[model samples]
Target: MSARPAVRIVVVDDQEVVRAGFAALLDTQPDFTVVGTAADGGEAVLRCREQHPDVVLMDVRMPTMDGIEATRRIRAGADADAAPRILMLTTFDLDEHVYDALVAGAGGFLIKDVTAERLFDAVRVVAAGEALLAPSVTRRLIGEFTRLRPRPPAPELAELTPRETDVLRLVAEGLSNAEIAARLVVGEETVKTHVSRVLRRLGLRDRVQAVVVAYESGLVVPRSDVR
Candidate 1:
């Protein structure tokens, strides 16, 4: 069998040491290739446009421009299939700007203190066209933000069928495809179909956006007891 192509990646941070450190660590993985590194969001954008990486590890805060704006700009006019998946890097798990990053099109945010293995897994997950929302920190981050600033349901949300709505709720609750299948007493493929339809109908990019819309639309309420 042919070898799977390496996942191209770009590491961006204002701190020189942190940028080099992440790039070096990611390079150690056979499946990951660090195509470029940048000191700020502006430079990050340039590198991404030039390298066409599959994933970008972007710092949340930086000079010239912040990661959120860079993420928005990167996704704004780019083709959906070609846009790089952005994983925001933050110092704290509950950074106030994290919600904004998600809204700006980041697949997810990673705390800078994450272990090497976790970092590798996160990059792989995002690269595979999946959102890294299974982590408890991510759940808490979304829940807290939604609780503090709840919005009315979007009109597009009404387009979802009852089954698709249920799937979205379960997804917002951080259930995996297998878990949602078991909960609904259906086959995994059925669950996947519902999830896909839900994304298409809602015009959402991925499960992370689905979770945000679920909370914002009141289809799923933020639980104070999210663990």
Candidate 2:
């Protein structure tokens, strides 16, 4: 069998040490390649355009431009099939701007203090087109953000079938495909199919946006107990 292509990556941060550190560590992985590094969001955008990397580890805060704007710009400029998956890096698990970053088109985020293994796993998951929504921190952040700023249910949600709607709710609750399958008494592949159809029908970019829509549209109410 042919070897799988290495996942091209760009590490972006305003801190010199942090940027270099992440790049060096990712380079240690045989399946990953650090194609470039950038000091700020502006530089990050340029590097992404130049390198056309598969994934970008983007710092949420920086001088000149923030990661949210960069993420939006990157998503806007690239075709859906070719756009790099952006993973925002933040100091706080519930960084105030994290919701904005997600809305701006980030696939997911990581706390800056993430372990090397967790970081590697997050990069691989995002590269494979999966959002990091199964993390408790992500669940809490989305739940809290939506609870604090509720919106009326989206009209687009009316398009989903009942089964697809069920999948979306479980997905918003931070359930993995296997977990959703077990809960719904279906095979994992069936759950994957439902989830994919939900994304396609809802016109969502990924699970993150689906979660946002679920909460904002009132399909999945945020629990006050989320923590």
Candidate 3:
């Protein structure tokens, strides 16, 4: 059988040291290839168009165009299924721009202090079209935003089975498949099935978008719900 292809990555950061460091470390991995690097969001967009990489590690802040705007433009130009996945990089887990990045189109984010292993894992996860919804960070940030923003109805949500809705709530709460299974007193595969159904029924591509829908639709709320 043919070996699986290496995941192509483009690292974008204003700092030369950071961009080079990520490229070097990721290149050392057998299944990862650093296809390119960029120092700002404009360059990020240009490189992404030029290389069509599997994933782009986008920095939240930059001089020419911010990551949020770049993410928006990239997503706008590509078919939803074909767009390259984006993993945002931020100095703080709660960086304000990150919330906007998620809304714009990032599949996940990494705090600047992330370990090499976690960073590599995040790239692989997003490249595989999985959502990197890190519980401690993602859920809390979503919750905070939910508390402040006005919830809009997501008409697609009305189509979910009650069980599917429950599963989505748990997912938005940042529970893993196993934890959700344990919480619902069902098998892990059952939880996975439910999660998958939720994604499909809602026309969502992955769990990250599901979480965004849960928040935007007010199906789940901060502090008072999902916990």
Q: Between prediction 1 and prediction 3, which has the larger lDDT?
A: 1
Clashing pairs in 1: none
TM-score, every prediction: 0.95, 0.93, 0.85
On residues 141-226, what C-alpha lDDT tens digit does candidate 3 reach at each position? 87677667756788888888888999999888777788899999999999989988997888766677788789878887766443
Q: Quantify all predictions' global Cα lDDT against the true fold.
A: 0.89, 0.89, 0.85
Model 1: CA > 4 A from native: none
Provide C-alpha RMSD values for all models, in order: 1.4, 1.6, 2.9
The local lDDT score (0 to 100) that residue 159 gets in candidate 3 is 88
Alpha carbon lDDT at 58, candidate 2: 95
In Å, residue 100's CA in model 1 sits off its true spot by 0.4
Candidates ranked by TM-score? 1, 2, 3
Give the residue spans of candidate 3 off by over 4 A: 176-205, 224-227
Better of 1 and 3 by TM-score: 1
Better of 2 and 3 by lDDT: 2
